[model samples]
Target chain A: MEKSKTNPNKDFYGKTLMGIEIFVRSLIEENVDVVFGCPGNAVLGIFDALLEISGIKIILARHEFGAVLSASGYARATGKPGVVVASSGPGASNLVTGIADANMDSVPLVIFTAQVPTKLIGNETFQEVDIVGITRPITKHNFLVTKIEELTSTIKSAFHIATTGRPGPVLVDLPRDILAEKFTFDYPEKVNLRGYNPIYSAHSGQIKRAAEIINNSLRPVIIAGGGVTISNAFGELRELARKINSPVATTLMGQGVYPEDDQLSLGMIGMHGTWYANNAVNESDCVIAIGSRLDERVTGDFNKFAPKAKKIHIDIDPSSISKNIKADVPIVGDVKDALKKLIPLVKNLNNEEWLSQIKKWKNEHPLKYKSTDKVSVPFVIEKLRDLTGANAVIVTDVGQFQMWTAQFFKFLYPRTHITSGGLGTMGFSLPASIGVAITVKDRPVISINGNRGFQINLQELATVTAYNLPIKILIFNDGHIDITRQWQELQWRKKFDEILIDSSCPDFIKIADAYGIQSFRVEMANEVEPTLKKALALKDKPVLIEFKTIYEENIFPYIPLGGSVSDIIEH
Target chain B: MRHTISILVENKFGVLTRIAGLFSAKGYNIESISVGPTEDPSISRMTIVTNGDDDQIEQIIKHLNKLIDILKVVDLTNEPFVERELALIKVKVNPYTRGDVIEISDIFRAKVVDIGPTTLTVEVTGKSDKITAMINMLAPYGIVELARTGVVALKREFKGEVYTSKEIKLIKKKSRQKQVEDDEKG
Candidate 1:
């Protein structure tokens, strides 16, 4: 909620102030500590303003994609709105994927794309692209500031909207001239928008009804997601789970919000989830879904997903409710707020019988890897988790390594595990960890990437070296895009793409060396521990460790496409 | 089922595209939508007509509310409402058929707004059904041109306005600020 009611400008509403200075001043007022961007001609005025500003630090990302991804990591880590700016045309276009990633994951980002001059907007001027038009569907909301008068309010509203209910990226595209233009400016003390109102708390009546359903349910389960982390509802989630004696299964994004090692934790649920979690959810009589969207990945086959469960969904966005599975009791508010009200209304009933049944299932079908002679990726993940004591901030790229990390690594704290769960964007971790490392200076931040994905944004190695962010880059080298290969192996008669060729894989250690970063390669199972220890011990600079594992290990506990929990692959 | 959705939105340039983009992205076809300014100059009212099942219609309203520029959404689909469409039909006419064309329009309570060399342009405002009947009656005369203001509607009860109580307070504060400024000047 906007608490500032008095317009600090007082008598200066119409007083002429340079647009460029107001831009920087507004960010300072918002308490923005850092900005990530690559400058171009269209952003000249922004660079000028930053030249005069003292406190705000501007870091140049090697690529525009890296800038936005780094900002996404920062937003997830610090729970503050991330800021990133880019120049017109190609620069603006490059930030689309990263912005879309943030949008999909509900990460709050305020992006500014400098545009060509207003007069040349439609005339196809040099280096001109309709970025606002391009980013329209991806962004939560966006503004094209044609007038200098609307600049301050647009910026204020962008920040407000980005940080509020169901937070996501909001872009503000400024024409170059508007930035340079002299405008009568006064920053609004409070944002007044007719169209935007976010519900912070839910109805007590709904909470009582949900509690009633829980009390009567003999088999109950809780599915948590990033919203749990975003709302900081970990304690409330734990309390609700213990009070009801329900097993907690999280979406891939919700990995660390509920400690994975907790007895109630069902690890991660979905296509690559534990068999026990999937079965528990499928057989549940009442499912309390807190802050998770229950996307297709989480609910494998909608027809059979929690088939018997009377769902009570708590989320800040009303649209997120019943977008997939219908909510029996939809509490439309902040998950944290709803959970707080709900904890008091519930009975302290531990369904010991139900929990014991889940424990038997977990024992029968535990998440484990084969006793392979080649280096095991899952073992490496587990060793690293054990070495870090499950407190390291783990960021990952898409595919097999990501699934393995979610399965083996037990995250103990909220925001400890970040990945491109929804968008599944490749090469997300390398740049995103830069954001996490920059925000969290005290914690050990690790970027775990597959060999194929690490090469996608390899240019960010220069950025990692320049910033000296102590991010341990763990590349699971299996010499193939194993996820697609797994599909080929299962669906086809082993006819594959050129994914298995050794010539296609690059030596990441040499690449890290070229970037002047400390590099290591571990090829033996025994070598994983000593190398990880060495890498995590080096606190001053970034290190890249490439782990060479068997090329053909497929992620199991699989749910076939359009397949239900009952049809889960056990082996 | 066809749903008549009335949305109160901020009168901004991108509001139209945002609404249009939202519907298109969700794979729903918008049959007809008309937007015009409300009594409050800063607010615009958009009436969108679309076809979907109950679940789809509910999802549509939720998506509309999700847009930041959309202030209020009322699915007046099931309510008692008054609906109207205004149409200007220009029909090809001979000197001999001009009188007959005037009589046909007159029967529908329409007006002959203009008479060209070989065309009788008639202006009609009524419910969409009535407008459809009038156009069909004139179809034999070789309709030359047609322009329509697609379905604009209002509930019979007139429940509320676009601004909320919070907006009124802000407006009062603004007026008070203006009063202080005027007093200082005087």
Candidate 2:
């Protein structure tokens, strides 16, 4: 208990500590058990400190990208903020995409990148890059510690900003010279931040007004997003929807916010949303957007998105409220708090006719893929979901496999679905799944990725073997980027730069084997289920199942860009 | 719609870039912006003047508040506020136009701080409109150079609230009415 404002460098009890040691102590205080990162010469002082500490453990990945992505997955699996400590220049630069992924997904992560000496900052020294400047836009907030005295308080602030109100990644860059310098460790007793207040509860008047509008509507629908998962508002979302007898549709990030198997569930909504979900949104009389930004991807066309409906948007960020669509009643608060206030005020009315209409649409436009001799990605996902009993954490890299999993997998619990939704960073799943497996030990952690994207962080397989994280990885090996190839074929593939077909055909099984991971390849449809069951059952070793799916299989019920929900293309 | 927004932020390096980056990233244009340290050396104030419709301006204000270093944000567009800007205009002053240039500077209440052999520099502090008017008058004299400190603004003391977002105008009006009714009752 020390006052940092009066004398920041004051010794707590007439003793000084190295900056890196102080950081390690602060991590222990923050209840962080492990940090994911790759160490370098710039951060050698930190590694020395870690060598002496027994309170914390560190996971060293092959690359900075893997390390950062692992931290992101760790944050998503647990509500607490994840931590990453990387070296300067290339190490920090390699983390850009993963850090952006965390920012876009609102995953809480506190990243530390060791910098060169203060004098060498502008002199173009070895391994010197303006990482703080490069990551400014992507990070929620960042701080560069030029003075040793400010290190402790800045780390505290970084954690606070990363974990609270619309959670996102924050970075703290410390020069090696500062870390090596001796400074008094004054851990402030209280956090004093003037500009970082987050509204946690809804204004009573706005909540009441929204409730009244929702109660009076004949057709009501709720669109939940990742914020629900971050807020732990799944129970509240369920309660509000059930009370109002409303159907629930979700954005890609909103996968597990509501149980997909429930009668009131309309699977994921928007671009690759279920036909019934998209139909319900288009035809609803009222649209209640909770914990979601109502992003352009989720709203196929802004003008036509829930156009006729009376809108109620509940989110932590005010800017997210009317950025894309002007909400009729914009409630700037945490969705859980807003929904808790809303459920009590709304009247319980069963819209039997509306529910029946949605049911009819579901029957007519069910998620269907042409079953052939070649096993499909959708089929594998369905098998994977069934084998895991809808309890495993599903992490997806970006592409058609991502959409397929969203379409077929039925998630029953919150924090059980993890993916690179907003930034859609390729090769995110392997490292992220390792983080997920570490955090959630009892349940299975599965990383489903496309062939080309999986190689983005294939080096992480060594980290996986090193740590012995018992996670399952699947690469739908259809060669080149399937989603891009699909779009090309649909619209002038002949005229464009040579179609990327059968490119980047790496032997994933061989690659996984080289890293000493148990890998299996399934060429036939019958081998998929048995292989998945066996892979998911392994408790000590990580497993990689290469499902040789056809590259031409495209995700359907896709709303073309600039097209409304009604303009879904079935081909 | 044009808006004058005043923001107080923690005095730190790179805060200006964060603010400027937000405007450009969102595709919003900042017509003119001015920033400097406030009375408290640890904090700085920024005055931003931008043109956009109501929705666009609303987003800008909300995004500004979202930045971690920003302490306070107030839109002085709808309030009674005093605005001032400093401009230095270097004008060509030949013998014929020298008297005319001095007369124009005196008419605008500007000071001819420096008088060179061929150029007269006028230092003026006034509302943006007044400065613009003087610049127009001196333009015919072949102005050599011009520099302006974008308008700095502060609301009149009678306007109470120091912090604002979206539409606190309704709250202010309601509170004023309540006060009036209480005064009558008393």
Model 2 per-residue lDDT tens digits across residues B109-160: 9999999899999999999989999999999999999999998999878645
The docking quality of candidate 2, as DockQ, is 0.72
For model 1, the stretches where C-alpha displacement exceeds 4 angstroms are A1-17, A499-503, B95-100, B158-186
TM-score of chain A of each: 0.96, 0.96
> In candidate 1, what are the lDDT values of residues A1-571, reduced to their tens digit?
1335452334445678788877887786677889999988888678768767536888788899999999999998989999998999998999999999999999999999998889989888888889899999999999899999888889999999999999999999989888888977667878878678889989999999999999899999999999999999889899889888889999998988888878999999999999998999989999999888989989988878898999999999898899899999999999889999999989998798998999999889999887675698899998998898987899989988899999999778888888998899998999999999988987899999988889888899999888888999999887878787887777775775664554667778789989999999889988889999999999878999988889868888899877888777765
TM-score for model 1? 0.93
Q: Per-residue error at A43 for model 1, in Å? A: 1.8
TM-score of each: 0.93, 0.94
What would the TM-score be for candidate 2 when compared with the true structure?
0.94
Quality class of the docking in candidate 2, CAPRI style? medium
DockQ of each model against the real complex? 0.59, 0.72
Worst 10 residues of 2 chain B by lDDT: B158-167
Off by over 4 Å in 2: A1-14, A497-499, B159-186
Model 2 lDDT tens row, A97-170: 99999998899999999999998897888998999999999999999999988887888889899999999999
Q: Best candidate, TM-score-wise?
A: 2
Residue A215's lDDT in candidate 1: 89
